[model samples]
Target: MTTSSNSPPLTPWGAAIITGVLLFLGYVGFDQFYLEWIFLLPLLWAIRDVRPRRAFLLGWVAGIVGHGGGFYWIIQMFQQFAGAPLPVGIVGLVLLAAANGVVLAVWAWGVSLLTRGRERHLVWIAPVLWTAIEKVWPEVFPNYLGASQYKVPHLTQIADFTGVLGVSFLVVYINATLYRILACRFEGKGVPWRAAAALGVTLVLVVAYGEFRIREVDGKVAAAQHLTVGLVQTNRGAADLHLSAGAIQQEHRDMSKALLAAKKADLVVWPEGVLSLGLPSREGTIPTWALGDLKVPLLFGACLQLNEEGETRFYNSALLADASGKILGTYDKTVLVPFGEYIPFGDVFPVLYAWSPYSSKFFSGKSVEPLKLGPHLLSVSICYEDIFPTHIRKLMRGGSEGRTPAVMFNLTNDSWYGNSTEPMEHLALASFRSIENRRSLVRVTNTGISAFVDPAGRITSRTGVWTREVLVDRVPLLEGTTVYGAFGDWIGWLCAVISLGAITLVTVSNRRDLTGKQNAL
Candidate 1:
C-alpha cells in the first residue's frame, strides 16, 4: 500500500481542482512551464486510494478544466468559424472538455486498475500510462504535455531522439517521484531513496544530453548554407469576412513588392489562401502582372479546383511560381480539419451542413510532396497540418530521396482563432517539427505570429497578431534527418504497447482474484 491503511483518506475534489488549475496555468494563461513538472502530482496523490470509477471522475474533472481553459479560444473560434452565438460557443467549450477530457479519465482509470493494492508502484506506472494515453488518445488540438517546455530549449533538445513524449515522460516521472517521497513522509514510512536516486540520475543524463545536442546543433547551424526568405502577414480576418478576393490578393502583392524592394530574398512567401484563386492549369494563365512584378520566385498558397469523374473538388494547396509567373509545382494539404474544413459524414447526412453553414466543402489533399525551387526542396504544410508531427514527418520523408526536404514551410491562416492564446500555442506546438527533423522552418500566417524557427527550435523575427508586417530573415537550409525524423515516435509507440499489455495482465489478474475469493467462500 502507498499510505498507512489506517490513516484517514483526504478529500479528492480539492486536489483535483488544484491540479486542474495548475494544468491551465502551466499550458495556457501563465508561462510558468515549471508547473508542468508538478501539475499531475495533486491528481495522482488524490487518486492513489480511490476506486477506479472515482479516480476517473476526478481525472476527468481536472482534464475538463485544463483543456477548457487552455482552449478557451475555441469559443471565439466557433463564433468566427461557425457563426455560433455566445451560448453555443460555451457549449462548444463544454463539449470539447468532455471529449478531450477522456484522455485524463482513461489515464486515471488505468493507473487505479494497475496499482490498486500496489499503489507504491505509481512511481513506475504513472509515467508509462500517461505517455501511452497521450500517444493513443486523439485530441482535436494535439497539444502534447511536453510542448509546455518549448521555451526551455535545453530541456527540449531531446525531442530529436524521443519526440515530445520524452520530455513528457521526464515531467511525469519527476512528479511521481516527488509525490512518492511526500506520501512516505505522510504515512511515516521509510524514505524512497531508490526512487530519488533514479530521478536524480535521469535528470543528470537528460541535462547532459541536452547540452551536448544544443552545442552540436548550434555548430551545424553556423556551418550550414542559408536561404534568405521574405515572409508576409496580411492581417486579414477570417475567411468568411467581408474582405474580397481582389483585396486579399492586392494586399499580398503590395507586401511582397515592398519586401523585395527593401531587401533581396531568394524566395518570398505569402500566407495560406492569400491568392484566393483556382490554380490555372496551363502556363501563362497567371499573368506576370498578377505577381506584382517581383523578380524573385514566389511561393504562395491557393485553391486547386479540379474536375474529375464528373465531380468538382476544391483543395487547400501551396503553389510555386517562378519570376516569370509560370507555374512550377504544387503541394496539396493531405490533412483536412474536421468541421472547420469539411463536415464529416456530411455527404450521407446532408442536413449536417445546415448545422454548420460556415464550414467549407474542401476535400483533403492526395499528395504530401514538397515543391522544388532551384536547389531548395521546400516541404509545405497548409494551415494546421504543421501541428501534427507524424504528418509533417511523412511530408519530410516524401519524394524519391526520402526525408530530404531542405527546409520546412507552413502557410497558415489563424484568423479563425482571433487575438488569443491559440496563435502562440499553435506556434509553440509547431516549433517541435524543426527540432524533430533538424531543418529550418518558416511559418507564414494571415493575421500574425509569423516567424522563422531554426533547426534548434528557436524562434526569430516573430510578428505579433493582427498586424500587417513584412519580415525578411536568412534561415538556414538544413539537410539530414534526426533520429525522430528517421524512425518517428518510437518511444510513444513502445509505451502504448506496454500500456496495452499491462491492461491485459491486470484484467486477467483481477478476474483470477475474484474467482479465488468466490471458490473459498
Candidate 2:
C-alpha cells in the first residue's frame, strides 16, 4: 500500500522528465527546417509542470539542442572554410551553443520565479518576461531571436517600432496560454476554458489586424513612386583576392560593368569590400585617373582611413558617390563583427588576435545615423548589422525626424559562408525589416541572394548565389511608419518591469503563508 502511494507521486516527476526531453528534441527537429512554430507547442508542454529549478534546467537543454542544431554549420565554416583543426572547431561550436543556451536558461528562470506555486491562474507574466529577456540578451547574442522570425511576414510587421521583441512577445504569450491550459488539466481541475478561449480570440484579432495592415500597404505601393536599383554580386573569395593590386582592380572593374549596364538605375550598390583597397581621401590612395570614370550615385563597400588627432584609424566603410565620381558621404559600420573584424579585448590579450587572418584592430563607426542620397534619406547597414532589429529601428527613427526614408540599403558580403542556407537566412531577416519599417529594402550581397524587398516583405526579384550578376528592380518608396517603429522597445521594458514586480509580490505572499503555517504548528 505504501509502495503504491509512492509510485503515484513519482509518476508526474517521470512524466515531466520525458516531456522535457521530447520538447528539446522537438525544438531540434523543427530548427532543421527553420520551422520555428513547431517548437512553440513543445515549449508549452515542457513548462506545464514547471518547478523553478527544473524549468531552468529544461530550458537550458532545449536552448542547447535548438541552437546547436540550427547553427551547426558554424562548425563547417570554422573547420573547412577557416581551416581550424577539428577539435578547436568543435570546441568553438560548443561554446557558441552554450552561450545561446544561457539566454533560454535565464528566460526560464525568470518565468519560473514569476509563476512559482501559482499554477491556478492564467498568468500573463511569462510572455512579457520572455520578450524582455529576448530584447536585452541580444546585447550578448545580437543575431538570435528576431532574425529567426524572418519567414513570418504577417507577424514581423510589428518589428518597425518594437523591433523583433514585439513578435517574440506575441509568440511567447501564445505558448504561455497553451501551458496554462495544460497545467489546469494536470491539476485535475476543470479546464480554465475561459482563458483558453480568450487566448484564441486574441490571436485571431492580432492576425486580422496584421492582414489589414498588409492590405493597406499593398494599395499604397501601387500609387507610390518607384526607384530603379542596380545591385552587384561579386563572387570573389576574401582569401584568394589578396593576390595582387592589379588583379583586385580588374575584379572591381568587371563587377562595375555589370552595374553600369543598368544606366536607368538611380542607385548602384556593391557588396562589402568589393574594392579590396581602401577609399581615397584628400591625400588620395586612389589616383585622379580612377575617380574620373564613375557614373551614377554609386554605393560601394571599402576600407577607409580616418585621421583623429594624431592617430590614423581604419574603418570598414560604405562610400556614396555621384555620377561624376565625386564622393558625397560615407557610413562606417558601427557594430563591428567580433573576431572577424577586430578581436574582443585584444589590447589585454593580444594572443587571442592571432586566431584569425584578418586585422586584430579594425575600427568601428561612431554612429548609427543614415546618409543623405539625392531626395531620399537612406539608412545604410553593413553586413550583419541588418540582423539586429533594434539598431535598425534606432537608425530609422533618427532618419525620420521630419520624414521617413524612401528605402533602406544593406551592403553585405556573405561569401564567408559560401553557398549555404546562411545566405537564405540572412535574406529572410532583411525581408522582415522591410515589412517592419514599411520601407523598401535593397540588399546588395556578394556571392548571392541579392534582391529587392517591398514594405510588405515580398521578395520582388533576386539573383542566384555565387553568381557574378547584376539584379535591377523597381521598389516602391513607402511612407507611413508602423506602431512598432513609433514606440521602440517600451513594450518589452514594461513587460520586464511587471514580471519582476509580480515575482516580488508572489515571493512575499509565499513567505507570509509559510510563517502562518509555522505559527500554527
Best lDDT among the predictions, by candidate number = 1
Encode model 1's per-residue lDDT on 84-182: one tens digit a residue: 898999999999988888888888888888988886888878899888988888887788888888888888889999988888888888888998888
lDDT of 1 at 307: 70
Candidate 1: residue 365 Cα off by (Å): 0.4
What would the TM-scores of all predictions be?
Answer: 0.96, 0.86
Per residue, candidate 2 scores C-alpha lDDT tens digits across 365-446 of 8766567777777888888888776778777875436566678998887776656666777787667778668888889876
By TM-score, the best candidate is: 1
Which residue ranges in model 1 land beyond 4 Å of their true spot? 1-10, 239-242, 280-285, 401-403
Tell me which residue pairs clash in candidate 1: 397-403
What is each predicted model's overall lDDT from 0 to 1? Answer: 0.84, 0.67
